[model samples]
Target: MKYSLLILTLLLTFSMANAQKIYSVDYENQADVKVFVVDYANQADLKVFKVKYQNQAGKNNGKWFFTKYANQAEKKIFFVKYQNQADLKIFFVDYKNQAGWQKNFKKSLLY
Candidate 1:
């Protein structure tokens, strides 16, 4: 009975390890404007897009939206509408992988 319990515990632990989430972040700068791209796990049905922005009090805010990516007649990409400010910064958040949100920009970008 003790050995059976041990085997069951090991099986649960292995299953939990394999079920992990993955996320990626990309940035682009053109003509003094910066854009951030966040890509998560791609399945057959849906995709997630997120945009992060910094408010006047130096706090970060984010919004998430989803759209169909496969087998659709029209392809759409969501964009954020914010005032044109040279001081805005971007970051990404990944909760499923046990990774905390991180700033994607350098210190110099804040200025």
Candidate 2:
């Protein structure tokens, strides 16, 4: 019984540790851009990506996509483009401060 309890406790602890929250931000006005937030234990990474529009005739449709990866120690932001048509911009901010990176996204982007 004691061993079973210990095992259960360990499982729960591990489950909790593995659970992390990630955030993504996309705007209706700009449907081609994307932002991602990757969270770590000590740091986090913010990644941004822009999507290509099908028809660029009348209006420019660009959206921002965002996501967060939690529990990462070394926060690094990166952007990748395939055909050079789409671009991305990443920004990293501290996680501790109330008005820090995470909060900033929530307030600014309403995420």
**Alpha-carbon RMSD, each predicted model:** 15.9, 15.5
Badly placed stretches (over 4 Å) of model 1 are 22-111
Q: Assess the local accuracy of residue 6 in candidate 1 as a C-alpha lDDT between 0 and 100.
A: 100
Q: Which residue pairs show backbone clashes in model 1?
A: none
**Residue by residue across 16-79, what tens digits does model 2's lDDT show?**
3432222232332333333333334223222222322211111111122222432321112232
Compose the digit string of candidate 1's lDDT tens values, residues 64-110: 22223222211122223442432333333453232222444433332
Count clashes in each candidate, considering only residues at least 3 apart in sequence or on different chains. Answer: 0, 31
Superposition-based RMSD of candidate 2 using all C-alpha atoms, in angstroms: 15.5
TM-score of every candidate: 0.22, 0.23
In terms of TM-score, the best-performing candidate is: 2
Candidate lDDT scores, in order, read 0.30, 0.31
The TM-score measured for candidate 2 stands at: 0.23
Off by over 4 Å in 2: 22-111
